[model samples]
Target: MKLKVVLRKAYDYVRYDLKEIAFPSSLPDPPHIKKRRKLTWEERYLVLKEASRLYAASWVRDIGPDLRPNDYKKYDDGEEKPNEVNGATKEKEPSTLEDLAIAARGGMETLKPALQRVYMTRASAYRDALKSFIEGYKEGVQQVMEKKENSGTQGEEDSPKKST
Candidate 1:
């Protein structure tokens, strides 16, 4: 008797409950897709330029205190000695942006490597994000195209054919 009751309940669940769950009366609406526009070259340049300036400012602010001129001073009986490296006097570390530029010997060559690394890192990250965005956009476009084709075919099948 218990086995019979259990089998009947299982059959009812499979027949009625499973059908409603698998094929609901209504489905939720599809999500709306929005198009994303690419940035213009001038806008991209300005954004990267501003980001570089901010990054440089923060880098300078963090290292400024450590590079103070007084930190390198040598007191020797009222005479200051220059920093010596391998028995030869070495130039003092620059404590300000102006001093650093001057120390660079009048060209941007000294700063190129560090700035290049920063730009490369930023460019790589931007490239990855843009790649992902483009891939998703393509997928969305494909989905929209498939949906349109499917609907068009269904509409034709459902409508009566008119004689020409």
Candidate 2:
């Protein structure tokens, strides 16, 4: 084989076997890259609050197979119409909350829309409700933390720890 052809084949083989390649130098920082900074105490609280709200709503979404997230709070299970339960007929079809709990556990298949009647309406309502819950829970946690901090400072002044 010609020298050039032999070299080309070897080069092609190496290239094909290589799975990845690295730049000769570091690439530019991504435009969307964010700085690493600790969140302020309040921001941390808000983060926790929001997480809790999302978690709560996600659980609520697990209602019956027919139920959607929107109706999780309002839909009544058909059991109320008179369905046999545990060996006997129960009173209600099962409240929205009950269905959700069951659904979360993999009992139900779907949920009906309770409040999200329309498109924009549902998106807006769900967004607001999640924000509200997050803020409320965050504030509650902050209040408790403040109370504990205050009590601790006062305790130090009023009755400092002493060696036995």
RMSD of 1: 28.6
Local accuracy of candidate 1 as per-residue lDDT tens digits, 37-114: 899999999999988876676666344333465556546765644432345445555454555556467568766754
TM-score of 2: 0.27
Q: Indicate the worst ten consecutive residues by lDDT in candidate 2.
A: 108-117
Give the TM-scores of the predictions, in the order they appear.
0.33, 0.27
lDDT of 2 by residue, 1-164 (tens): 99999999889867764433432446778999987898999999999998887667667634343435454344366534222245554344776567556555663343334322344566898999999999999999999999999999998899967889
What is the C-alpha local distance difference test score of candidate 1? 0.75
lDDT of 2: 0.67
